[model samples]
Target chain A: MNGTEARTIAAPDLLEMCAAHMRAGGRMQMAYVWFPQAGATPEIRYLASQGANQPFALWCCRPQPGEALPSLAKISPLLGWYEREITELGGVHFDGHPEPFPLVLHEGARSTLPPLDPRYPADQPVEFEAAPWRIPELGGKDVQLLPFGPVRADVLESAQFLFFYIGEGIIHYYPRLFFKHRGMERRFQGLCPKLGTVLAERVSGVGSVAHALAYCQALEAAASCQIPERARWLRVLLAELERLYNHLHYLGYLCHTTTLKVGEAEGRLLEERAKQLNAKLTGSRLLRGIIEPGGLRRDLDSAGLSDALEALRREFADYTARLERTDSHLDRLISTGVLTRKVAVDQGATGPIERASGLDRDLRRDHPYAAYAELPMTVALREAGDACARMQVRIAEIETSFALMQRVLLLLPAGPVRTDCHPIAASEGLGWSESPRGSLYYAVHLDQNGKLARVKIKSPSFSNWRAFPFTVHDSNMMDYAINEASFGLTTAGCDR
Target chain B: MPLWTFFGLTRGTATTAWPASGADNGQTGVLGMPRHYPDRCQDDCDACAAACLPGAIRVHTEASAGARLDVDYGRCVACQLCTEVCPAGAFAPSTDWAFGVRARTDLVWAAATQTAPARALSGMIRSTFGRSLHVRHVDSGSCNGCESELQALNNPFYNLHRLGIFFTPSPRFADLLLVTGPVTYAMRAALVETYQAMPEPRWVMASGTCAVSGGVAEGGYACAAGLEGILPVDVYLPGCPPNPAALIEALLLLLGRAPQRIEGGRLAD
Candidate 1:
């Protein structure tokens, strides 16, 4: 499969193509399918995985008029939502989706059609209907539903589940959300490419680098622009640093919640030290404004890079020593929220969560992007899928990320940070990167005026949310908080 | 009962006696009027006006003098961004944190003409100390920055409990309501309910620019009005998001320990 080789197939043959790709031992890296309302036709393009020996395979297929695209229920039930979302956004209708409703964009809400459609106007009043999922009521002699917050007493961006019990055990857990919905997706439309970076960074304040990098990759790909080698290396450094900090913060939160005082203290110290190092390197403790399209806004000096490396080494040793002595902390986390390997795969969980569940899948290694292709990465795995298993995976990944950062810094190439990128004409492209959470996918279509026509960002949170309910099935309700904390799911990332 | 108890009984008393002391309660002075320096002006800069989330700073430009900056301390939330971003270091926050006055007119002190007056509480030698305050916090739809720092008060560093400030879970038990965020439409009723539940002699302390004056979310449909529009706010601690130190000072001022002035820079112990 070559880049120039695009195979066009009828809509009825969409599922057959997917089945064929799977049989050929090809993995679906990303799939971007769109249909103009006027044309009422679907165009499917995907980068399928062949073996390591072959280049990335690209395939394009379209359904003929009055024909239906194949359903995903045959391949996997999880693909149902993905198919429905593509249908709702691009006006493509799937023949046999078990459930089909708008995923991110609200139903009936006014939105621009696919960029290829000339008949659809830009802005219109769109009304959105609420999703039709019955809120499960736990009915027992004493069981009741308790909604904690869309507005919480604490200053956190999430909802809580309280399972009212007589004394020690929980009866049911009710989940609530939509607290801080700033209408980010609606605002992303018609935004200039440069300003999109700011929007992406705010998607998840903690996962700022990941979101920005993914968005930049999409923009770069669409415009056929090349980022400098030095910038690519720096981008990887920032991404890995983000991953390290997020994992550290998650571990600290888990410790704090579980009443592991020493472990909590160590986690806090690691976070503070990491933040300070990040500040020294990027001026902002959160590493904002560091990543821009084409490359970075500023380059790291040798002295700054050296200081970061030194700080990393010092903190890593201290953290590792503290982790070793804390057996009690490990006891609380292990076997807590045990997601079985079968369940993890069925739910399509990714990142540390999937890897912890004995699934050795990592975008950095499986589908290499940016500097990851050249850098060595070891996929961390644990069979437990419990809270402790997740923590172990994160801990291992942090060490690996630190090593990768050190390697990148030692082999620092001399070049410019940014490349002069020209605006791209009307074209569509898919961008995928491994965010700290999981695989982040962005599908973008550029208009003739070089403005963003339509963008569908499938953040890792979207896919990972499905796995949460399954993990809490047999586990006690009290452990749910620890389970969620260990996952470090950002509501902002998911909501956006 | 142990051998160590018998040995420890031989130690002297930990109490200490000092010189004859007055009934001097450890209270800091009030904030003073803000001052401005002309030399620190930057070209085409009106940050004092822009950074004023309360819309307190008024910038006037004439043909000869270029730009003139004036701040209304009454409207100011004391966020200190003007001082923080002043390129010429012209805007100085006065150490005189206390500026308790009977009338609202006395609160508005111009920076250019006014001299730093004597501490406001120095003249009032009162025998009466205020009662301990019970503060109730309400989230009126803020960015959570204010609430984040506010939560830090419970931490070991800024132990708000030591300052006679207790956060009540219910507004009924609260003597003061610490409201953050601009009053969103959804939160307006809750705000009113919380304010109504508090007993008489009750005071409201708007803890951020959003609470005092709708900071960034001013004109949104979600926002109703600042805390003043719903309840009477006695003290205002301003910042895009106020630091923990500034928050501590504001709470202290409410308890008659610290003074309220438009001073900029670091808070002295």
Candidate 2:
């Protein structure tokens, strides 16, 4: 096969070949069980992308319905969560799943019937329920489990967490998630592609632009439509601004945990300023209503955000300097909630988390989506896997985003920002973008009528949260707030 | 460090001088709720109605006038798509973020419709808690759209504490309960329990379109169409998620500290 070819393999050969690919340093990027028709059987597809620059997509599909599906997660433990999601939504049992717990569905939750299942009855009530939080048997008898939040202290999104501790030092924790689920995937089942873009924006308010961009890219791919050159550059600009606002919030909150009130205020100030800039450019602060199928709903370059961006650059330089001068702030970060390189790679961690751990994985550079192909990308990397290293990576990325936004504004190719995109029919397209937190992958399947059949959104938080319990292995409970803040994981993104 | 102290002192008072000092309440640059004009609406026009994604706009045709548009501000996301597609100048664009009102009916904007008469509040309760307020914010099931704006209320820019409003973690100390999200079924019991925990005469402010009318996810499997059926809402502040200034305006209106500035989806004089 060529450098970028995807070869579909048989079910029996999936586990063996996938292991072979991983042995050659490959990663299972995204896995989803897609439904074809109302009465037709669903097929499990695994997107296997390996190699740094010389990359080729190897997508494996298990075609047979009645046969025992080979669980690739058995070989790679990181694939367990995705496999669990596939099993729950498809209502199919994997042969040898290790952690076969519920990932999305929970107790007292009643959602759509397994739309993929041939025997799925429209009237059948599939109760989405979960048993009591199973505290893993660990440490000693003195270790007590303390429950925290569906309604929390500061954050907006909702998710319950069970903390297991012997004394003050935290040991183990289980996140009882999915409280913010709007049944997003089930709702996108038959929406028109145009309306689907609107729904995709709400997946995570913080990552709205990236999600909508990803969804739109998938829509364009399904329709075999190419958006205008100017729209590509505009998408890049909006995505960079989105990253800026998100990183500003992430950095601000992390500093706030250290009782740095002034820094927190400054962070929020910068965030609001960025939102104002976004509103001026895209007509929405969160960068919504701009990203649509085929192109943006409006052209941002015409809005002339260049002068405003230049001002941001000057302000950010000073802001970063003032915050960096505080040695005590750095003291709280160094060696706090450290994630090892082995765990980050083996578990397929992404975004700043992976970059902080020196994994050198970024969808923007490796996958080259949108206008990224137009620019020379520098994927920031850090050797240290601690909180300080993570912050360093993020700050460095924020600086880079400032420069990137300027580049997008200056070098933007002149053309139409949109083109006519017709309804797609019976096609599947994969959309991946480097969101503020990390890589966002969306697998969109269109029905014969070109309506949205299914959309599986893969958030970077999903992968990063798996490493969270591991990051808190030896850190003090007090330092946990700062540690989690440094990671800056969004529960809304994860829940959706 | 002395430098840190210097920087802190140098950046004094970034707060907007609103209400007391006549600051621009963020009405510039951004577009807000759409204003509907019945007289100007063309006969048999459904362009804006069809363009509305969340079904915020509906057309009711009469024999005399032919077509009339009714906008449910509760369901309106303020994406301004209706303004973009309206053939006639009927659905005009507005930057009206100060859409906070005492009654839920104030959110709906039917062409040629007048503002609903304000309902009388219990005078004893209003007299009990006069001015300074303690707010208990519950993220019933928001995507964090409203929550983000709510957080901004504490920033140096908004500086909500100066206005006598603060967020209390415990429902016990709260005078007003601020609710976000479309009120998912899983969160309904918790919301009820929190509401119960609050002292008597506690007012609930539904802060986003989702909490007001479940914006896009309205009537989904997991949730109701916002806080309508769940609790008696004292104030309905509608937007996709109201901006920070709007939230403040809503809070002030709830406390009788500020007057309702929007009537029938238009800025009142």
Candidate 3:
């Protein structure tokens, strides 16, 4: 582990150690069961970090036969999703786990063995029968339930939402997402590191560069390959470019939710321009097929990037200023879908969602990936934790992203963009990047043949999705879409 | 004056005059699909096939044919790994982005003589719903790339609604069922239910490489090989995530409002 510390501890000591780590202000980033060889006991790994310039601390353990591991969900609520996934996919049991239910697999989906188990046949299909979502029973007068999606209104990702609302006000909200889970992590198994970047880029289309950067950096660490200076700076540029478009789209989509048609059109037009800039710089509108393990797949011409940045800076200023002064949009967002600071930290909120809740943690400044360590970066924060606060945080971040991109272009070094990278056998590494949404991590484990043994993705949306229902539980139905747009959560990221 | 109105006037019109001949579809100097040049392929070379993660390019060997490259553009995600790894320049980087076609057979390329591609939509479909097309998009399992582009279609730059194409929330009112992703097992039933709900004259368009032939996640544990074997796909537009312009072109081509630029897996002038 290049920038992390790994410890092998007894399975029983896991909970106590994790509690101590949390007390020391470290946040749990990822927890997954790693299956090495056939018939071998599954190894559970817990990764945590205190953010910014702190090395990741990973604790690994293997439970004894029939010994159920103590759940970490009590200490960190977000680990419930991880533990539920571990149970359904890895067949691991956690004692005293709250809300012990199938997280990834639907009710009627069947498999002879856990899909993550090495003994499970890859060719065998996991048979699925369309089963009704297990929405909880909440008894209250006038609290009628309305089940929306897997197929939702407008061009939204598939996820079912059970709204237990009293007329227009929501009493309880239960979301059943992951309808778009394409076995992304499992697809990485047996793939060469070169092709792994391709799959990673498609993990979340909008977060293509961030995902690719994280995946490539993981492999790069495994190979002990130092990417060229130009490539690192270029990575920063591309990442910021992605952030620019995503934030712009978020703003536009938020407007769509608020019924601000003119604002929506303007924001989308700017987003389209930003995408065109991406196309001009990297040949891919979504900025895919450009990044690889060692470095960039090809060199980018920065000649036009600066000119585009200048034009965008002027246009974005006008857009955001108008948005801030707009009373109707601000009024709708001000106190709508409020998530307090304590709940954000407890539910493991990352990215802008956590930032809006007044948690001043940013991986770019904290973990310092790519060229972020060298580049001057600022973290945007807001205390309100409402839709308006989330919008303001994104607005500030868009400004920061623009500044960062400009700086990268100014200081981009001249060198070969790529290096010869070959994965080392039986090597593994952890890589993280501050994606447009939040901290995205890729854990790569290579087999004996230098092929990917297993890859676990911790997408920011996965963390934020766990934190989303908190805001909707007592909110109104009218503000639900606005709240969601403000958070900018994607089901693909969560499902993957 | 209202701030929006003032800004709108200053920015002027951002819409592109595409689908009306010689307009920039906004995809300039962009790499589309990899153009397969079998003539330039070196003997005993399998670099392109090995590099292709989606198995879009395969080398089929037979006693009569010896060895030949079989390329299915439908399966290509346009990663361009083939173009990079091919030492012989067998696969060239191309900008021939407009690949929307009526028949699935039009997307598969072979070293042998190609079969004729399908004709335009029937007179009933053309005459009945040529001017207006209502689409119901289902994300069986996408990375949200297709959805991002789909949303962009409504942006001022593209404004697909100006061409009489609208995304309807209800499948019952839709004339076209646009499907994206690899048709993940979890989303299959929902996709089917949506198609079943569409009116009798409904058509299905497999939008994106994942929808066309599952792209990279094809045949994985969670998903099938896209909409091909699952549903009757009338229009197949393949891209990792097609740009907004490509989506508009595909929708128009489906309504028989535009010509099918790709035939037998080759882009025609």
Candidate 4:
């Protein structure tokens, strides 16, 4: 979207105008498609936004039933996943999709009804289709295939990785995940308004605050409800805390993967402290239950967080200094599993991954939500596009988040924590927010009863997962673990 | 390496003393299973159940029997919604950490009078695996909430190995099957196959509420709620995703090392 406001476009010019807009330097922010209960035709709206002066062109396309929808994946490979997602969920087929595969509803079981379809048989069994999406492989005679997991020794999320290798180095790897699909989006439709906030927090457990904020943002937008100023500041406070803890844990895990014991230990300790701090601030370690629609669930003392965060920031810099000084850590990360800027931009990578590749896109700055505009922040940037660069970006971001949090705490406005949020029946709205990893979004359509008719979530993981195959290509098989860890892709989020 | 080594030495150990002493864990606040008080429930009130996302809390009201509220902890995600919505304060926050039991019935804190108190494991079964326990974890369909705490078990603080609990890489070597997540249809075969791969005398511990009663994804068309019919679970440790401390308590209870502090939803005095 070019400007700050949203501009509506007719159904016919959805794809062509979007292509032209992008040609005119517009960015394809997200494409949200949904099934309207009363009608057979699905509503497809593509939000193309970029730059300060440009308005976000909301291209609402109504693809006639059985006709193939125009594919944006052909023009921008970044939208392949989104286009494929629309196909699987909205039951709209997009012509010219590079690889149109089922991202969530996999093939293997008995053929079942389309999960989110209005005509879906609720009582019927979810059987697999006769010919479902299959994992395809690129071949070479010298290449040997090795499978990694849907299950592993560690408490890793269930995801299978098939590494096509020639000798010790991988030529390419196909990751087959979503063995953890819990029909979350389907359940969201059936959830009560009050319960939506609770489950939204659990969308990708670690990003609870971000997801909750996104869900609430969508609800508030639909209802046109304004939360208290204090509530907005609290949201920022909790979000930054969530970011701090996740980055610590992610950094620590990356170190562990690379055999940097000291870095790993420091990361764990810092993450633990962050969790404890969160518990003290919000009554839960991961900051759950503190956020919901309208405002917070209840209020607690945030006074201690600033001091703890300051201490953490100081300690973090010292630990990172020691970490960077180590040759073993640096050697393993430097150019290991490099992702090019081209691949990142093409695949629409966000957060540290994009920043590491020199894209410098942080949704918090680009599209400010919550109290981000009030508490101004800087976007952390790096250009190496390596695992090390990703780590550097994360470390830098942690410091920035800490500083931002201190400012938010000092300048917090006092008011009510929560208020009544009533959504209008037969209304639809979009909510987007910057999570620890990247931009997280949710598109919700309410029924006549003011209940959720459908909710299509586009988590950061969904966009970032496309970069994985590119990242691991031709890299040493041993570096696979490091590459995976560096991306911080959540299998649960992707599967959802 | 020397500087880091020095830093590590100065920082010292961060391990917690749980089974040995007091293990401060992720147990405080609105995180664990709610302690339901049926007696305190408002007459014909369905607030908590109505507020429940997965229908974990059920209120059945008949003219003759009046109203009865039953909480299936396995289905509850510990969102503390029940605590917030219950006007009667029927659902209160609790500190009952040692929640593991051999029977699934033990996980149910009901509105009706208890018929069967959960019995300890059979002497023959306990004796077969008396010395130590090796767990093989299966991500049946977890959101990684349970997996995070499970990973914490290996971190510097918990050090689950100290308690003679080790996570094995293979089901063949595993003495106990520790499963997380609601049993999704995609993983149904994998779950059964993993159990099949395990040797005889292998016990099963349904770790989270999802494994025991399917948490929030209970009865979806694509997934099975809980592991009730799928497998015979020995230890039903119910929590949305039980904290590491709770897991420690659960394991200790399995070994008859820690006292079972919870019974019928409340802390047994």
Candidate 5:
């Protein structure tokens, strides 16, 4: 595949077009396909339906060879993965696809090809062969293969990374996940909207509010439900607080990883104080129960407002003082784990990772949702793109969030916390939010009965995971932990 | 000394001794819930039951009389949603935060019972000298919030280790297995395995709503019913995820120390 010519193929031109786009300096992002239900199709009928509210159309084609694959350029580069996914799951082959293999399921599983329809024999067990995965065996070279954990010494819910090292310097790192894959997505097949948000909340613990907000937004948009102004503002407040605490904790982790005691202590202090304030205001330390389907479950009173603001102001002041005294911590972070500005842009990194690389792209700023448009948001940027740069971006974000919280508190409108939300008769909508990890997008399709026909969540960790393989190249393996901590990628978000 | 140093010395002494005095006076810091109110109870409202995440609040409405709401202190996460959302302001958080008990039945508070007042001697003895506790955490497949807060205990504010409480890595060394999340099907085996590994003096503390009663994952094929189905949970900390202070109080209670309690509209002290 050359750069100049766009390759044309008879079988699924959409897949070929995606390959051509990637060959021509465009990166193949994400791709997945869904099938709509006509209520009669039986072969592949068990596949989930793309509800009415999703952004893209679910086009079904016969299992014949030679169809004009739609051009990939029409959709965002991130949609590339979706295309490959559709081919593998639906057996709709994309001719000239760079990597044509099964994605979600194991390889060589079933004998009879499942129809792309959603009404087929829903329980046919298919025999499939596992796909080949390369673990990069370093062998007898100076680079030793080290395996870390499917378990950690700490009580947190995550796996560890084994670092292959040469003396004090690390050569390679292997991250063992799947310790927390409880198959949440598989359970969403037949659930209604009211019950779906509960599942979304448990996807990742800390980002519960963000996930719930994104899921609700998708449902709301698909249903074309108008959220009250107060609900929107409260959502923004909760989201900013969520982002603030997460970023603060990330900074603390980064400092701790670098062995900077003072910085670690300060970071820990800020996090504790932030959580305390969050509980004082919203009642949940992690801000869980505050978010309900249509709007907030409860309202924040005047006393709550004053107490939260006062606590935030004091913490912010203390943070600034501590920052001045932690030069040694900053020294270790500045130039380590450098993901150059060019690489960050080409890879389409999002959130603080992109901001640190000097790419000034923020979902709040670019696609302003909720109260973010009302206030002036200072998107922090750093040219280094290293672990240190990432830390700086998080610190700046915390500062920015503190300012935003104050603004929201001052401008808070007097109104009811929620509006009466009714079941959607029939609708579909797209919902996206800038989670602490990055941009989180959800496409929701509602059945005629107002139940969730299908839901597709694109979490930031999916895209950021690509950057990890690239970031670790030619870098010492020991820095992998620091690099990963700086990124704060959630496996649950990605696996979902 | 510099001005900052002088201030630090003065402030450190003041702040360090505050927790000790506050604990003695039946105040559990800023995070602690206020004392519960009996007079303000309304016949119509069961606000605490509705707000409870773990369904720890049991409300019975009488046809001839007013409704009664019973809160199982063991099952309460101390999210304070019940206190905050209560319209009549009848519900108050117990300033006596420490309430770890030997039996799950003891944590259950009956709204109908106007029983003999809780023993005052327990609060006094517990406040004078803190107790030692050993915690073993089991992930029933959670989002890690409870674990994170538990980890934060090593920090300055909570300083759990200073109270003779240590978080052991292995179940063999554990006195209590602190479980979080609804026991998912995938984690059910692992939960049982961890429980079996623990020594005999072991107690299970179900931390989140998920752990106590399968939380949001309740009724799903992936989730087991709750911790009790596999192992008997002695204490229940009810929140989607409980606050760090609430957890500390629960731990203190387990070590034979009762947090300061109020009786008949008066502080226990």
Candidate 6:
């Protein structure tokens, strides 16, 4: 899995090569379909990365029209979602795929050709007529079905949960998310690299900096444009700020789910303070409108950045220390919605979820991007594989993020924050970032006019959401909401 | 529990006294929507229009006169790209975060014609739900930026409940339907159903630039251009994702508890 360049293998050897990579401890990072040229036959590509500090192994195969390709889901169950996604969007058939229903396209949704297929007429509109999804039947007198939402309570995103539970215990759990899909990846098409940052930042509001950084890096990689040193350090600063706010928000939301109202209030207040810091440092609270392809959109005035981080750090330590002392919060998190290490790896979990499950991997450390290689970071690991472990992972990561931000600010260089990124036509590149939720990757393909031809987003939430359902089955309904909160998933990330 | 209570008390009044005169709205030095000066704009220059991706700025050619740039704040994401690209110093970045208005037409601006003043809500509607308002938020196709600001409204800083506005779980109990995103087709049914479920005198507020005029993902294969022709909207607040204080101002303006500061798509100084 250490091959740096993408190799075009025949369709027959795709499964064998992937299996070998899997046997060598390589995990499938992402797979997608793209048209190599205008009206060209679609090619399905697979990307896999070996353990720490190794280059990704990329393999692609173009199947003749109507040719059924071998399913890699058998070798790695994590590929099930990607395979099904390719089947629906790329209009490819996977031979011997188990349980091949529509992954993204809902029932009664109509589109000419698959939406991701380049041949699909962009001008023609796709209609999503509301129709009932096929829910797997469960037999038993006590087993009843409950469809929770496409619209839920509170300020949560749109996602529906189909629960088949008997009494308090659950028989099965199925989540039908992606109600918030805005065709974000497609929106990148024909956009200049400058405007692309705006759309990438909006991919997931909380992961704004991470997505934008990854997108810009991909664009930079394509053109081999070397951004300024100050821009790299600033990217790290912005990234850490994003992680700080997201983790704090996650902790606060988790507190609400556990009925820790005071803890929730304290956490949110701290989150608000952190956001205010972001606003004071950068004009935008979410740190948007500052990242473009070559570098930052503007130079930041980080005069009081270290002071703000120190103050936030002190308050956060006190808050988390109090939470640890409270037994009620711990009781709800312990042993609730346990996702075993084996299941986590088998289902290809990433970020804190994987680290909490004892799969020690951080893209910042393993495959360093931005200024991460220069900074000292401790990848937090836990063996519990439960909600408590997840919370602990986030708490530890927040601490590391604070330290990293301080280091980045101290070593900040003086130079221009941006450079001219002249796009190289017909070039493709891969870029990644270790976001608060997990590792996020953006693959960009540039057109003749230096605009985006095709852009594929491998968001962390997409991977985590695929692995989330494993913990829900056979678990009681009581801990469902808390489990969900601990995962800290966003429907926009998945749906996009 | 006692420790938490004492700890909370010691933090000492984190709430801001906004909606009152000279209060800190918590958005000091933050960039808001782009402010346009028709006089400063060059007649042939369309740099801002070309830079705006959401099609918020468009140059319209009229047979009777010169080309006029139609500026729609409803579609503006406030990315400030307009200001960055404008050569004639026409589009200036301003801190006018409070851009909420009662009518959709109030969001569109043109240099040729003067716009009418924004109208306040009807007396009956305002008086009916003046003291308190229950809101049901729907995410038709948002990227969750709007939801983040919505969540921030409950923080101790903003404390939206103090203003008699609450986010309810049920549309049946909702007086106002606060909608976000560009109204994607897949969510069209659920959004409409929620609107139908609400009782009479129910109003819809399109928060964020996406809900106002589809933001950057406008006219895509999957979504409609905001809530324009889908449902009748009462309030239109535009931002890439409006900050928390802006949400409070919009909600308050909707309830007739606060005055509409935007007239003819221009912020009142």
The iRMS of the candidates, in order, is: 9.1, 2.7, 1.3, 2.0, 6.2, 1.1
By the DockQ metric, which is better: model 5 or model 6? 6
**Residue by residue across B1-269, what tens digits does model 3's lDDT show?**
28788768877778888868677778776679988887788988899999999999988766455337889999998999999999988899998777898878788874443644555354567888868989898999899999999999999988988998898999999998989999988899899999999889889999999999999888766889899678898889999898888888888787777787887778764
The 10-residue segment of model 1 chain A with minimum total lDDT is A122-131
> What lDDT does candidate 3 reach at residue B167?
89
What lDDT does model 2 reach?
Answer: 0.78
> For model 2, how does the per-residue alpha-carbon lDDT over B124-143 read when each residue is reduced to its tens digit?
43587766789888887777
lDDT of 1 by residue, B20-124 (tens): 123211112222234556567676788667655445676765545533665545455443446655777767655333333222333443333343333443223
Q: lDDT (0-100) at residue A68 of candidate 5?
A: 29
Tell me the spans in candidate 4 whose CA falls farther than 4 Å from its real position: A1-14, A52-55, A109-113, A129-133, B26-30, B63-67, B111-126
Tens digits of lDDT, candidate 2, A1-496 = 1224667777778788878988988877767787777766677767767766665564657566666677777777678888887776776667778886667666545446553453454224345453465456676778877888787765356777778887887877777777776666766776778888777887787888899988888778777888889889889888999999989887788878887877888888888888888777666778888878888776664455778878877877788887787887888888888899988877777899988999887888877878888787777889889888888888899888888888887788887788988865888777879998898988888888888888889988888887777888765788888988899887777777
Q: Give the TM-score of each candidate.
A: 0.69, 0.94, 0.98, 0.95, 0.74, 0.98
Measured with C-alpha atoms, the lDDT of residue A257 in candidate 3 is 93
Candidate 5 C-alpha lDDT tens digits along A273-357: 7776676676556776567667776787535665666676676566545554566656666667777776664555778888888
lDDT of candidates 1 onward, in order? 0.61, 0.78, 0.88, 0.77, 0.60, 0.87
Q: Docking category for candidate 5?
A: incorrect
State candidate 4's TM-score.
0.95
- Regions more than 4 Å wrong, model 6: A1-3, B63-67, B112-122
> What order do you get sorting by lDDT, best first?
3, 6, 2, 4, 1, 5
* lDDT by residue for model 4 (A1-496), tens: 2123565555456567767876887677677666776457777777666664234566667777777777878777888877876776667788777887666666754433356676665435577543544656577789888887677766778878888889898887888766777777877775566679888877788888889988888888888888888888888888989999889888889989988887887888788778768766766666777788888888767766677788888988888888778898888889987889988877888878888999867767766778887766888888899999999999889988888888988888887888888888887677888888888888777888889888878788888887778988788888888988999888877786
Worst 10 residues of 5 chain A by lDDT: A42-51
Question: What is candidate 1's CAPRI-style docking category based on DockQ?
Answer: incorrect
Give the per-residue lDDT of model 6 (tens digit) for B140-178. 989888898899999988998988889999999999999
On residues A1-496, what C-alpha lDDT tens digit does candidate 6 reach at each position?
1225578889889889988998887888988888777677788988888778877878888999889899989988988988998887778899999778876878878887878766676645687676777878788898889999989998879989999999999889999977777788878877887788888999998899999999989889999989999999999999999999999999999999999888999999999999888888878888888898899888999997799799999999999999888898999999998999999988888899999999999989988888889899899999999999999999999999999999998999999999999889888888899999898989898888888888899999999999999999999999999999999998989898
Worst 10 residues of 4 chain A by lDDT: A1-10
Select the stronger candidate by lDDT from 2 and 3: 3
A273 Cα displacement, candidate 6 (Å): 0.6
lDDT of 4 at A238: 89
> What does DockQ give for each predicted structure?
0.08, 0.48, 0.77, 0.60, 0.19, 0.77
**Candidate closer to the true structure by DockQ (higher is better), 4 or 6:** 6
